[model samples]
Target: MELIEVADAVQLGVERMGVGPPVLLIGGLGMPSQIWELSGLTAALVDAGFSVIAYNTRGVAPSTATEPPYSVDKLASDAEHLLEACGITEALVVGYSLGCYTAQCLVRRRPDMVTGAVFLAGLQPSPIGALVGQMELDLIGRLGEIPAQVRVFEQLMTTLSPAMLQDPETVSIWRQLLADGDSLWSDRKGLHGQLAASFEWIMNEEPHPEHLAQISAPVLVLAFEHDVFFPPRTSRETAQQIPNSQFKQIDGAAHGGLFSNETNVVETIAQFCADQRHRLDGGGSRYASP
Candidate 1:
Protein backbone atom coordinates (compact mmCIF):
# COMPACT_ATOMS: atom_id res chain seq x y z
CA MET A 1 0.00 0.00 0.00
CA GLU A 2 1.27 3.48 -0.97
CA LEU A 3 0.01 6.81 0.26
CA ILE A 4 -0.47 9.43 -2.42
CA GLU A 5 -1.82 12.91 -2.04
CA VAL A 6 -4.66 14.10 -4.23
CA ALA A 7 -5.93 17.62 -4.77
CA ASP A 8 -6.30 19.75 -1.62
CA ALA A 9 -3.76 17.68 0.30
CA VAL A 10 -6.16 14.76 0.66
CA GLN A 11 -4.12 11.58 1.13
CA LEU A 12 -5.41 8.71 -1.00
CA GLY A 13 -4.30 5.20 -0.07
CA VAL A 14 -3.71 2.86 -2.99
CA GLU A 15 -2.48 -0.67 -3.45
CA ARG A 16 -0.79 -1.43 -6.80
CA MET A 17 -0.29 -5.09 -7.61
CA GLY A 18 0.30 -6.84 -10.96
CA VAL A 19 2.08 -5.70 -14.10
CA GLY A 20 0.31 -5.04 -17.41
CA PRO A 21 -2.34 -2.64 -18.65
CA PRO A 22 -3.44 -0.37 -15.81
CA VAL A 23 -6.82 -1.21 -14.26
CA LEU A 24 -8.23 0.93 -11.46
CA LEU A 25 -10.62 -0.75 -9.02
CA ILE A 26 -12.96 1.51 -7.07
CA GLY A 27 -15.00 0.16 -4.17
CA GLY A 28 -18.58 0.93 -3.13
CA LEU A 29 -19.83 3.16 -0.34
CA GLY A 30 -18.71 2.46 3.26
CA MET A 31 -16.49 -0.45 2.28
CA PRO A 32 -12.76 0.06 1.75
CA SER A 33 -10.41 -1.77 -0.59
CA GLN A 34 -10.50 -4.68 1.87
CA ILE A 35 -13.71 -5.78 0.23
CA TRP A 36 -11.71 -6.54 -2.90
CA GLU A 37 -9.08 -8.29 -0.80
CA LEU A 38 -11.66 -10.87 0.24
CA SER A 39 -12.56 -11.70 -3.38
CA GLY A 40 -9.03 -12.56 -4.56
CA LEU A 41 -10.06 -10.81 -7.75
CA THR A 42 -7.10 -8.43 -7.51
CA ALA A 43 -4.67 -11.31 -7.38
CA ALA A 44 -6.47 -13.00 -10.27
CA LEU A 45 -6.27 -9.84 -12.36
CA VAL A 46 -2.58 -9.58 -11.53
CA ASP A 47 -2.04 -13.17 -12.59
CA ALA A 48 -3.80 -12.39 -15.86
CA GLY A 49 -1.16 -9.75 -16.64
CA PHE A 50 -2.95 -6.58 -15.63
CA SER A 51 -1.65 -4.01 -13.17
CA VAL A 52 -4.48 -3.37 -10.70
CA ILE A 53 -4.79 -0.38 -8.38
CA ALA A 54 -7.43 -0.50 -5.69
CA TYR A 55 -7.89 2.62 -3.58
CA ASN A 56 -10.04 3.73 -0.71
CA THR A 57 -12.34 6.43 -1.93
CA ARG A 58 -12.43 9.73 -0.06
CA GLY A 59 -13.91 9.47 3.43
CA VAL A 60 -12.86 5.84 3.70
CA ALA A 61 -9.94 4.34 5.59
CA PRO A 62 -6.59 6.06 5.05
CA SER A 63 -8.22 8.70 2.81
CA THR A 64 -8.97 12.10 4.18
CA ALA A 65 -12.63 13.01 4.35
CA THR A 66 -13.77 16.40 3.19
CA GLU A 67 -15.61 18.65 5.60
CA PRO A 68 -19.30 17.71 5.91
CA PRO A 69 -20.36 18.23 2.26
CA TYR A 70 -19.10 16.12 -0.61
CA SER A 71 -20.30 15.38 -4.12
CA VAL A 72 -19.73 12.82 -6.85
CA ASP A 73 -18.04 15.46 -8.95
CA LYS A 74 -15.55 16.03 -6.15
CA LEU A 75 -14.93 12.32 -5.88
CA ALA A 76 -14.43 12.13 -9.66
CA SER A 77 -12.00 15.01 -9.53
CA ASP A 78 -10.10 13.19 -6.80
CA ALA A 79 -9.83 10.16 -9.07
CA GLU A 80 -8.53 12.30 -11.89
CA HIS A 81 -5.94 13.87 -9.64
CA LEU A 82 -4.93 10.49 -8.26
CA LEU A 83 -4.49 9.12 -11.76
CA GLU A 84 -2.39 12.07 -12.80
CA ALA A 85 -0.35 11.78 -9.64
CA CYS A 86 0.32 8.16 -10.44
CA GLY A 87 1.30 9.07 -14.05
CA ILE A 88 -1.54 7.02 -15.50
CA THR A 89 -2.51 8.64 -18.79
CA GLU A 90 -5.41 6.34 -19.48
CA ALA A 91 -6.66 3.29 -17.59
CA LEU A 92 -9.40 0.71 -17.52
CA VAL A 93 -11.75 1.80 -14.73
CA VAL A 94 -13.81 -0.82 -12.90
CA GLY A 95 -16.31 0.54 -10.39
CA TYR A 96 -19.07 -0.95 -8.24
CA SER A 97 -22.14 0.81 -6.83
CA LEU A 98 -21.20 4.33 -5.63
CA GLY A 99 -17.86 3.90 -7.30
CA CYS A 100 -19.77 3.58 -10.59
CA TYR A 101 -21.21 7.04 -10.04
CA THR A 102 -17.71 8.40 -9.57
CA ALA A 103 -16.52 6.60 -12.71
CA GLN A 104 -19.36 8.08 -14.77
CA CYS A 105 -18.54 11.54 -13.53
CA LEU A 106 -14.88 11.00 -14.36
CA VAL A 107 -15.77 10.05 -17.94
CA ARG A 108 -18.13 12.96 -18.22
CA ARG A 109 -15.56 15.41 -16.92
CA ARG A 110 -12.45 13.98 -18.53
CA PRO A 111 -13.20 11.48 -21.25
CA ASP A 112 -9.67 11.61 -22.59
CA MET A 113 -8.31 9.98 -19.44
CA VAL A 114 -10.47 6.88 -19.59
CA THR A 115 -9.52 4.05 -21.94
CA GLY A 116 -12.46 1.84 -20.96
CA ALA A 117 -14.95 1.43 -18.11
CA VAL A 118 -16.81 -1.39 -16.36
CA PHE A 119 -19.72 -0.68 -14.06
CA LEU A 120 -20.78 -3.55 -11.78
CA ALA A 121 -24.07 -3.40 -9.97
CA GLY A 122 -24.31 0.28 -10.82
CA LEU A 123 -27.22 2.42 -9.81
CA GLN A 124 -28.96 4.65 -12.32
CA PRO A 125 -31.08 7.69 -11.75
CA SER A 126 -34.87 7.65 -10.93
CA PRO A 127 -35.76 4.59 -8.84
CA ILE A 128 -32.22 4.09 -7.64
CA GLY A 129 -32.27 7.60 -6.27
CA ALA A 130 -35.33 6.68 -4.22
CA LEU A 131 -33.63 3.63 -2.79
CA VAL A 132 -30.51 5.58 -1.92
CA GLY A 133 -32.62 8.28 -0.30
CA GLN A 134 -34.09 5.71 2.03
CA MET A 135 -30.63 4.40 2.87
CA GLU A 136 -29.47 7.90 3.64
CA LEU A 137 -32.39 8.44 6.00
CA ASP A 138 -31.61 5.20 7.76
CA LEU A 139 -27.99 6.14 8.21
CA ILE A 140 -28.87 9.56 9.52
CA GLY A 141 -31.23 8.07 12.09
CA ARG A 142 -28.44 5.89 13.54
CA LEU A 143 -25.69 8.48 13.42
CA GLY A 144 -25.56 9.19 17.14
CA GLU A 145 -26.12 5.59 18.17
CA ILE A 146 -22.97 3.58 17.52
CA PRO A 147 -24.24 0.22 18.75
CA ALA A 148 -27.45 0.61 16.81
CA GLN A 149 -25.52 1.64 13.72
CA VAL A 150 -23.21 -1.37 13.92
CA ARG A 151 -26.11 -3.71 14.48
CA VAL A 152 -27.96 -2.30 11.50
CA PHE A 153 -24.86 -2.54 9.31
CA GLU A 154 -24.22 -6.14 10.29
CA GLN A 155 -27.81 -7.04 9.48
CA LEU A 156 -27.61 -5.27 6.14
CA MET A 157 -24.34 -6.97 5.27
CA THR A 158 -25.79 -10.36 6.07
CA THR A 159 -28.65 -9.76 3.66
CA LEU A 160 -26.18 -10.13 0.82
CA SER A 161 -25.79 -13.52 -0.90
CA PRO A 162 -25.40 -16.28 1.68
CA ALA A 163 -22.20 -17.34 -0.02
CA MET A 164 -20.56 -14.10 1.10
CA LEU A 165 -21.50 -14.55 4.76
CA GLN A 166 -21.06 -18.29 4.73
CA ASP A 167 -17.39 -18.12 3.91
CA PRO A 168 -15.64 -18.87 7.18
CA GLU A 169 -12.59 -16.85 6.32
CA THR A 170 -14.66 -13.88 5.20
CA VAL A 171 -16.84 -13.96 8.30
CA SER A 172 -13.81 -14.24 10.56
CA ILE A 173 -12.16 -11.27 8.96
CA TRP A 174 -15.34 -9.25 9.32
CA ARG A 175 -15.63 -10.16 12.98
CA GLN A 176 -12.07 -9.10 13.67
CA LEU A 177 -12.65 -5.85 11.76
CA LEU A 178 -15.80 -5.08 13.71
CA ALA A 179 -13.98 -5.64 16.98
CA ASP A 180 -12.14 -2.36 16.47
CA GLY A 181 -14.50 0.16 18.03
CA ASP A 182 -12.52 3.20 16.95
CA SER A 183 -12.34 1.99 13.37
CA LEU A 184 -16.03 1.28 13.36
CA TRP A 185 -16.94 4.71 14.70
CA SER A 186 -14.66 6.55 12.33
CA ASP A 187 -15.89 4.51 9.38
CA ARG A 188 -19.47 5.12 10.39
CA LYS A 189 -19.00 8.87 10.03
CA GLY A 190 -17.39 8.43 6.67
CA LEU A 191 -20.08 6.06 5.52
CA HIS A 192 -22.80 8.47 6.52
CA GLY A 193 -21.09 11.26 4.65
CA GLN A 194 -20.72 9.07 1.58
CA LEU A 195 -24.38 8.13 1.71
CA ALA A 196 -25.41 11.78 1.92
CA ALA A 197 -23.24 12.76 -1.02
CA SER A 198 -24.44 9.82 -3.10
CA PHE A 199 -28.09 10.59 -2.43
CA GLU A 200 -27.64 14.22 -3.44
CA TRP A 201 -25.77 13.26 -6.58
CA ILE A 202 -28.42 10.73 -7.64
CA MET A 203 -31.31 13.08 -7.01
CA ASN A 204 -29.92 16.38 -8.27
CA GLU A 205 -27.01 15.77 -10.59
CA GLU A 206 -27.55 15.64 -14.33
CA PRO A 207 -28.51 12.21 -15.60
CA HIS A 208 -25.48 10.16 -16.68
CA PRO A 209 -27.34 8.67 -19.67
CA GLU A 210 -27.34 12.11 -21.28
CA HIS A 211 -23.58 11.85 -21.73
CA LEU A 212 -23.39 8.21 -22.87
CA ALA A 213 -23.07 9.30 -26.48
CA GLN A 214 -20.14 11.50 -25.51
CA ILE A 215 -17.99 8.74 -24.02
CA SER A 216 -15.36 7.66 -26.52
CA ALA A 217 -14.16 4.67 -24.48
CA PRO A 218 -15.36 1.09 -24.70
CA VAL A 219 -17.85 0.32 -21.93
CA LEU A 220 -19.06 -2.82 -20.20
CA VAL A 221 -22.03 -3.03 -17.85
CA LEU A 222 -21.97 -6.05 -15.55
CA ALA A 223 -24.98 -6.91 -13.45
CA PHE A 224 -25.85 -9.81 -11.19
CA GLU A 225 -29.06 -11.78 -11.77
CA HIS A 226 -30.16 -11.27 -8.17
CA ASP A 227 -28.76 -7.85 -7.29
CA VAL A 228 -30.98 -6.36 -4.62
CA PHE A 229 -29.65 -2.83 -5.01
CA PHE A 230 -29.85 -2.19 -8.76
CA PRO A 231 -31.60 -4.73 -10.93
CA PRO A 232 -30.18 -6.14 -14.17
CA ARG A 233 -32.74 -4.04 -16.04
CA THR A 234 -30.91 -0.93 -14.90
CA SER A 235 -27.66 -2.17 -16.39
CA ARG A 236 -29.46 -3.20 -19.59
CA GLU A 237 -30.89 0.27 -19.99
CA THR A 238 -27.52 1.82 -19.29
CA ALA A 239 -25.97 -0.36 -22.00
CA GLN A 240 -28.68 0.67 -24.44
CA GLN A 241 -27.93 4.31 -23.76
CA ILE A 242 -24.25 3.83 -24.54
CA PRO A 243 -23.66 3.04 -28.18
CA ASN A 244 -22.21 -0.45 -28.70
CA SER A 245 -21.70 -1.08 -25.01
CA GLN A 246 -21.80 -4.72 -23.87
CA PHE A 247 -24.02 -5.83 -21.00
CA LYS A 248 -23.78 -9.14 -19.16
CA GLN A 249 -25.68 -10.51 -16.19
CA ILE A 250 -24.04 -13.29 -14.26
CA ASP A 251 -26.30 -15.94 -12.76
CA GLY A 252 -26.40 -17.07 -9.08
CA ALA A 253 -24.96 -13.77 -7.91
CA ALA A 254 -26.26 -10.86 -5.95
CA HIS A 255 -25.22 -7.21 -5.70
CA GLY A 256 -22.05 -8.07 -3.82
CA GLY A 257 -21.39 -11.17 -5.90
CA LEU A 258 -18.63 -9.50 -7.86
CA PHE A 259 -16.53 -10.01 -4.75
CA SER A 260 -18.09 -13.27 -3.58
CA ASN A 261 -18.09 -14.91 -7.03
CA GLU A 262 -14.52 -14.00 -7.88
CA THR A 263 -13.79 -16.57 -10.58
CA ASN A 264 -16.61 -15.56 -12.90
CA VAL A 265 -16.16 -11.82 -12.37
CA VAL A 266 -12.44 -11.98 -13.03
CA GLU A 267 -12.87 -14.16 -16.10
CA THR A 268 -15.60 -11.95 -17.50
CA ILE A 269 -13.56 -8.80 -16.98
CA ALA A 270 -10.45 -10.39 -18.48
CA GLN A 271 -12.39 -11.45 -21.57
CA PHE A 272 -14.02 -8.07 -21.96
CA CYS A 273 -10.69 -6.27 -21.67
CA ALA A 274 -9.15 -8.62 -24.23
CA ASP A 275 -12.01 -8.01 -26.66
CA GLN A 276 -11.66 -4.26 -26.28
CA ARG A 277 -7.91 -4.49 -26.87
CA HIS A 278 -8.54 -6.52 -30.00
CA ARG A 279 -10.99 -3.94 -31.28
CA LEU A 280 -8.58 -1.11 -30.60
CA ASP A 281 -5.72 -2.91 -32.34
CA GLY A 282 -7.86 -4.01 -35.29
CA GLY A 283 -8.32 -0.39 -36.37
CA GLY A 284 -12.00 -0.57 -35.50
CA SER A 285 -13.74 1.73 -33.04
CA ARG A 286 -14.99 -0.10 -30.00
CA TYR A 287 -17.71 2.42 -29.29
CA ALA A 288 -20.17 2.93 -32.11
CA SER A 289 -20.21 6.40 -33.59
CA PRO A 290 -23.06 8.44 -32.21
Candidate 2:
Protein backbone atom coordinates (compact mmCIF):
# COMPACT_ATOMS: atom_id res chain seq x y z
CA MET A 1 0.00 0.00 0.00
CA GLU A 2 1.37 3.36 -1.05
CA LEU A 3 0.16 6.85 -1.87
CA ILE A 4 0.45 7.93 -5.49
CA GLU A 5 0.77 11.63 -6.10
CA VAL A 6 -1.79 12.49 -8.76
CA ALA A 7 -0.96 16.19 -8.57
CA ASP A 8 0.67 18.62 -6.17
CA ALA A 9 -2.08 18.27 -3.60
CA VAL A 10 -3.87 15.18 -4.85
CA GLN A 11 -2.17 12.08 -3.52
CA LEU A 12 -4.41 9.00 -3.57
CA GLY A 13 -4.10 5.96 -1.30
CA VAL A 14 -4.08 2.82 -3.46
CA GLU A 15 -3.92 -0.89 -2.76
CA ARG A 16 -3.40 -3.43 -5.58
CA MET A 17 -3.74 -7.21 -5.60
CA GLY A 18 -3.60 -10.19 -8.06
CA VAL A 19 -2.07 -10.21 -11.51
CA GLY A 20 -4.57 -10.43 -14.33
CA PRO A 21 -7.25 -8.25 -15.88
CA PRO A 22 -7.33 -4.95 -14.02
CA VAL A 23 -10.44 -4.34 -11.91
CA LEU A 24 -10.87 -1.00 -10.17
CA LEU A 25 -13.02 -0.97 -7.06
CA ILE A 26 -14.58 2.23 -5.76
CA GLY A 27 -16.15 1.92 -2.28
CA GLY A 28 -18.97 4.02 -0.81
CA LEU A 29 -19.13 6.89 1.68
CA GLY A 30 -17.06 6.45 4.88
CA MET A 31 -15.56 3.24 3.52
CA PRO A 32 -11.84 2.99 3.18
CA SER A 33 -10.46 0.52 0.61
CA GLN A 34 -9.76 -1.86 3.52
CA ILE A 35 -13.31 -3.21 3.48
CA TRP A 36 -12.60 -5.11 0.26
CA GLU A 37 -9.97 -7.29 1.90
CA LEU A 38 -11.85 -7.63 5.19
CA SER A 39 -14.92 -8.88 3.29
CA GLY A 40 -12.81 -11.39 1.26
CA LEU A 41 -13.73 -9.66 -1.99
CA THR A 42 -10.11 -8.98 -2.86
CA ALA A 43 -9.24 -12.64 -2.58
CA ALA A 44 -12.35 -13.79 -4.44
CA LEU A 45 -11.69 -11.48 -7.39
CA VAL A 46 -8.03 -12.43 -7.43
CA ASP A 47 -8.86 -16.14 -7.40
CA ALA A 48 -11.20 -15.48 -10.29
CA GLY A 49 -8.30 -14.02 -12.27
CA PHE A 50 -8.47 -10.31 -11.72
CA SER A 51 -6.01 -7.67 -10.60
CA VAL A 52 -8.06 -5.81 -8.03
CA ILE A 53 -7.19 -2.19 -7.41
CA ALA A 54 -8.90 -0.71 -4.40
CA TYR A 55 -8.37 2.87 -3.33
CA ASN A 56 -9.39 5.12 -0.46
CA THR A 57 -12.13 7.39 -1.72
CA ARG A 58 -11.49 11.11 -1.46
CA GLY A 59 -11.60 12.37 2.19
CA VAL A 60 -9.97 9.12 3.29
CA ALA A 61 -6.30 9.25 4.26
CA PRO A 62 -3.61 9.72 1.58
CA SER A 63 -6.17 11.00 -0.93
CA THR A 64 -6.11 14.76 -1.15
CA ALA A 65 -9.08 16.80 0.04
CA THR A 66 -12.07 17.60 -2.12
CA GLU A 67 -11.42 21.31 -2.79
CA PRO A 68 -14.96 22.51 -3.32
CA PRO A 69 -18.09 21.16 -5.00
CA TYR A 70 -17.18 17.53 -4.43
CA SER A 71 -18.86 16.43 -7.63
CA VAL A 72 -19.05 12.78 -8.70
CA ASP A 73 -17.13 13.80 -11.80
CA LYS A 74 -14.15 14.80 -9.66
CA LEU A 75 -14.15 11.42 -7.93
CA ALA A 76 -14.28 9.76 -11.37
CA SER A 77 -11.27 11.75 -12.51
CA ASP A 78 -9.39 10.69 -9.38
CA ALA A 79 -10.18 7.07 -10.27
CA GLU A 80 -8.94 7.60 -13.85
CA HIS A 81 -5.70 9.10 -12.62
CA LEU A 82 -5.25 6.32 -10.06
CA LEU A 83 -5.53 3.78 -12.91
CA GLU A 84 -3.12 5.73 -15.04
CA ALA A 85 -0.62 5.82 -12.18
CA CYS A 86 -0.77 2.04 -12.05
CA GLY A 87 -0.10 1.93 -15.80
CA ILE A 88 -3.52 0.53 -16.64
CA THR A 89 -5.39 2.31 -19.45
CA GLU A 90 -8.67 0.44 -19.06
CA ALA A 91 -10.33 -1.95 -16.67
CA LEU A 92 -13.62 -3.32 -15.41
CA VAL A 93 -15.23 -1.35 -12.55
CA VAL A 94 -17.02 -2.63 -9.47
CA GLY A 95 -18.70 -0.14 -7.18
CA TYR A 96 -20.89 -0.18 -4.09
CA SER A 97 -23.36 2.56 -3.04
CA LEU A 98 -21.71 5.93 -3.43
CA GLY A 99 -19.04 3.98 -5.25
CA CYS A 100 -21.77 3.09 -7.73
CA TYR A 101 -22.38 6.79 -8.23
CA THR A 102 -18.66 7.27 -8.79
CA ALA A 103 -18.58 4.36 -11.26
CA GLN A 104 -21.44 5.86 -13.25
CA CYS A 105 -19.55 9.10 -13.37
CA LEU A 106 -16.43 7.29 -14.56
CA VAL A 107 -18.19 5.54 -17.41
CA ARG A 108 -19.99 8.67 -18.55
CA ARG A 109 -17.15 11.11 -18.02
CA ARG A 110 -14.37 8.81 -19.22
CA PRO A 111 -15.90 5.96 -21.16
CA ASP A 112 -12.64 5.17 -22.88
CA MET A 113 -11.12 4.06 -19.58
CA VAL A 114 -13.83 1.52 -18.72
CA THR A 115 -14.77 -1.86 -20.21
CA GLY A 116 -17.66 -3.20 -18.11
CA ALA A 117 -19.07 -2.35 -14.67
CA VAL A 118 -21.07 -3.75 -11.75
CA PHE A 119 -22.94 -1.24 -9.61
CA LEU A 120 -24.18 -2.49 -6.21
CA ALA A 121 -26.60 -0.67 -3.95
CA GLY A 122 -26.68 2.02 -6.58
CA LEU A 123 -28.42 5.37 -6.29
CA GLN A 124 -30.56 7.05 -8.93
CA PRO A 125 -30.80 10.79 -9.37
CA SER A 126 -34.37 10.97 -8.06
CA PRO A 127 -35.97 12.91 -5.26
CA ILE A 128 -36.49 9.74 -3.24
CA GLY A 129 -32.93 8.64 -3.70
CA ALA A 130 -31.76 12.09 -2.77
CA LEU A 131 -34.04 12.14 0.23
CA VAL A 132 -32.97 8.76 1.54
CA GLY A 133 -29.34 9.55 0.90
CA GLN A 134 -29.74 12.86 2.70
CA MET A 135 -31.43 11.16 5.60
CA GLU A 136 -28.50 8.78 5.88
CA LEU A 137 -26.06 11.67 5.86
CA ASP A 138 -28.05 13.56 8.42
CA LEU A 139 -28.24 10.54 10.65
CA ILE A 140 -24.51 10.02 10.38
CA GLY A 141 -23.84 13.65 11.25
CA ARG A 142 -26.11 13.41 14.26
CA LEU A 143 -24.17 10.39 15.39
CA GLY A 144 -21.29 12.90 15.23
CA GLU A 145 -19.37 14.17 12.21
CA ILE A 146 -16.43 11.97 13.24
CA PRO A 147 -18.13 8.94 14.65
CA ALA A 148 -16.72 6.60 17.26
CA GLN A 149 -15.79 3.09 16.15
CA VAL A 150 -18.73 1.55 17.99
CA ARG A 151 -21.03 4.10 16.42
CA VAL A 152 -19.74 3.16 12.97
CA PHE A 153 -20.33 -0.51 13.72
CA GLU A 154 -23.82 0.20 14.99
CA GLN A 155 -24.66 2.30 11.97
CA LEU A 156 -23.52 -0.41 9.57
CA MET A 157 -25.43 -3.08 11.46
CA THR A 158 -28.70 -1.24 10.97
CA THR A 159 -28.36 -1.61 7.20
CA LEU A 160 -27.85 -5.38 7.30
CA SER A 161 -30.22 -8.34 7.75
CA PRO A 162 -31.13 -9.71 11.15
CA ALA A 163 -29.53 -13.04 10.29
CA MET A 164 -26.21 -11.32 9.73
CA LEU A 165 -26.41 -9.18 12.82
CA GLN A 166 -27.47 -12.22 14.88
CA ASP A 167 -24.10 -13.84 14.52
CA PRO A 168 -21.87 -12.79 17.41
CA GLU A 169 -18.72 -13.78 15.55
CA THR A 170 -19.68 -11.65 12.58
CA VAL A 171 -20.34 -8.69 14.83
CA SER A 172 -17.00 -9.03 16.60
CA ILE A 173 -15.10 -9.32 13.33
CA TRP A 174 -16.68 -6.24 11.81
CA ARG A 175 -16.40 -4.27 15.03
CA GLN A 176 -12.64 -4.78 15.00
CA LEU A 177 -12.63 -3.92 11.33
CA LEU A 178 -14.42 -0.69 12.05
CA ALA A 179 -11.83 0.14 14.65
CA ASP A 180 -8.99 -0.68 12.28
CA GLY A 181 -10.54 1.31 9.45
CA ASP A 182 -10.96 4.41 11.59
CA SER A 183 -7.24 4.64 12.06
CA LEU A 184 -6.70 4.95 8.34
CA TRP A 185 -9.34 7.47 7.23
CA SER A 186 -10.68 9.19 10.32
CA ASP A 187 -9.69 12.73 9.46
CA ARG A 188 -12.85 14.49 10.62
CA LYS A 189 -12.38 17.69 8.69
CA GLY A 190 -11.74 15.89 5.43
CA LEU A 191 -14.71 13.62 5.97
CA HIS A 192 -16.98 16.59 6.63
CA GLY A 193 -15.72 18.24 3.45
CA GLN A 194 -16.51 15.15 1.40
CA LEU A 195 -19.98 15.00 2.90
CA ALA A 196 -20.45 18.65 2.03
CA ALA A 197 -19.59 17.87 -1.58
CA SER A 198 -21.95 14.89 -1.59
CA PHE A 199 -24.76 17.14 -0.34
CA GLU A 200 -24.16 19.62 -3.13
CA TRP A 201 -24.32 16.91 -5.77
CA ILE A 202 -27.46 15.36 -4.33
CA MET A 203 -29.39 18.63 -4.11
CA ASN A 204 -28.22 20.40 -7.27
CA GLU A 205 -27.82 17.48 -9.68
CA GLU A 206 -30.29 15.42 -11.65
CA PRO A 207 -30.03 11.81 -12.72
CA HIS A 208 -28.43 11.44 -16.12
CA PRO A 209 -30.93 8.95 -17.57
CA GLU A 210 -30.15 10.01 -21.14
CA HIS A 211 -26.47 9.10 -20.76
CA LEU A 212 -27.35 5.47 -20.11
CA ALA A 213 -28.42 4.93 -23.71
CA GLN A 214 -25.09 6.17 -24.99
CA ILE A 215 -23.03 3.82 -22.77
CA SER A 216 -21.71 1.05 -25.01
CA ALA A 217 -20.17 -1.13 -22.34
CA PRO A 218 -22.00 -3.90 -20.51
CA VAL A 219 -23.32 -3.16 -17.00
CA LEU A 220 -24.77 -5.19 -14.16
CA VAL A 221 -26.81 -3.46 -11.47
CA LEU A 222 -27.16 -5.29 -8.14
CA ALA A 223 -29.66 -3.98 -5.67
CA PHE A 224 -30.36 -5.17 -2.18
CA GLU A 225 -34.03 -5.98 -1.69
CA HIS A 226 -34.29 -4.09 1.59
CA ASP A 227 -32.04 -1.15 0.82
CA VAL A 228 -33.91 1.93 2.01
CA PHE A 229 -31.32 4.44 0.82
CA PHE A 230 -31.10 3.04 -2.71
CA PRO A 231 -33.72 0.37 -3.23
CA PRO A 232 -33.87 -2.46 -5.74
CA ARG A 233 -36.66 -0.69 -7.57
CA THR A 234 -34.35 2.18 -8.35
CA SER A 235 -31.69 -0.20 -9.62
CA ARG A 236 -34.34 -1.84 -11.77
CA GLU A 237 -35.24 1.56 -13.13
CA THR A 238 -31.56 2.28 -13.75
CA ALA A 239 -31.06 -0.97 -15.64
CA GLN A 240 -33.98 -0.27 -17.93
CA GLN A 241 -32.48 3.05 -18.83
CA ILE A 242 -29.25 1.42 -19.99
CA PRO A 243 -29.69 -0.66 -23.11
CA ASN A 244 -28.93 -4.38 -22.58
CA SER A 245 -27.82 -3.81 -19.01
CA GLN A 246 -28.63 -6.48 -16.39
CA PHE A 247 -30.43 -5.96 -13.07
CA LYS A 248 -30.77 -8.27 -10.08
CA GLN A 249 -32.16 -7.96 -6.55
CA ILE A 250 -30.54 -10.49 -4.28
CA ASP A 251 -32.20 -11.53 -1.04
CA GLY A 252 -30.79 -11.65 2.56
CA ALA A 253 -29.44 -8.10 2.69
CA ALA A 254 -30.09 -4.41 2.96
CA HIS A 255 -27.73 -1.51 2.09
CA GLY A 256 -24.65 -3.17 3.62
CA GLY A 257 -25.73 -6.66 2.52
CA LEU A 258 -22.88 -7.19 0.07
CA PHE A 259 -20.31 -7.30 2.86
CA SER A 260 -22.56 -9.42 5.03
CA ASN A 261 -22.87 -11.93 2.17
CA GLU A 262 -19.51 -11.36 0.58
CA THR A 263 -19.15 -14.76 -1.10
CA ASN A 264 -22.37 -14.45 -3.04
CA VAL A 265 -21.73 -10.85 -3.99
CA VAL A 266 -18.17 -11.56 -5.17
CA GLU A 267 -19.29 -14.48 -7.33
CA THR A 268 -22.05 -12.35 -8.79
CA ILE A 269 -19.53 -9.68 -9.76
CA ALA A 270 -16.96 -12.14 -11.18
CA GLN A 271 -19.54 -13.73 -13.46
CA PHE A 272 -20.95 -10.42 -14.65
CA CYS A 273 -17.58 -8.89 -15.52
CA ALA A 274 -16.55 -12.14 -17.25
CA ASP A 275 -19.44 -11.88 -19.68
CA GLN A 276 -21.11 -15.06 -18.43
CA ARG A 277 -24.77 -15.40 -19.39
CA HIS A 278 -25.77 -16.44 -15.87
CA ARG A 279 -24.42 -13.24 -14.41
CA LEU A 280 -27.93 -11.92 -14.25
CA ASP A 281 -29.33 -15.03 -12.56
CA GLY A 282 -30.61 -15.68 -8.99
CA GLY A 283 -32.46 -12.55 -7.89
CA GLY A 284 -35.83 -11.63 -6.42
CA SER A 285 -38.82 -10.41 -8.43
CA ARG A 286 -38.99 -6.67 -8.91
CA TYR A 287 -41.03 -3.89 -7.32
CA ALA A 288 -41.33 -0.28 -8.37
CA SER A 289 -40.09 2.45 -6.05
CA PRO A 290 -42.95 4.19 -4.16
Score every model by TM-score: 0.82, 0.81
lDDT for 167 (candidate 1): 81
Off by over 4 Å in 2: 66-69, 125-154, 165-186, 276-290
Candidate 1 residue-wise lDDT, 1-290, digit = tens: 67789876688878877666677788887667877777776776777666777898887877887665578888898888887777776777888888988898898888877778888777454464466566555756766433545544553463356576678787666556555634632345566667776787767744466687777788888887766666787668767888757888877776667665533887787777766554333232222111
Candidate 2 lDDT over residue span 1-290, tens digit each:
68887655778788888766777899987678888887777888778766788998877886766553366777788888787778776688998877887898889887877778888886564465566456546766687544465456655555667676788887777666566545555366556655665666667663467877887878888887767667777668768988858888887787787677533777788777666322222221111111
Q: How does candidate 2 fare on TM-score?
A: 0.81
Q: Rate the local accuracy (lDDT) of all candidates.
A: 0.71, 0.71
Name the lDDT value of residue 201 in candidate 2. Answer: 63
Query: Model 1 segments beyond 4 Å from truth?
Result: 123-129, 138-159, 162-189, 278-290
Residue pairs of candidate 2 with colliding backbone atoms:
none
Model 2 root mean square deviation, Cα atoms? 7.9
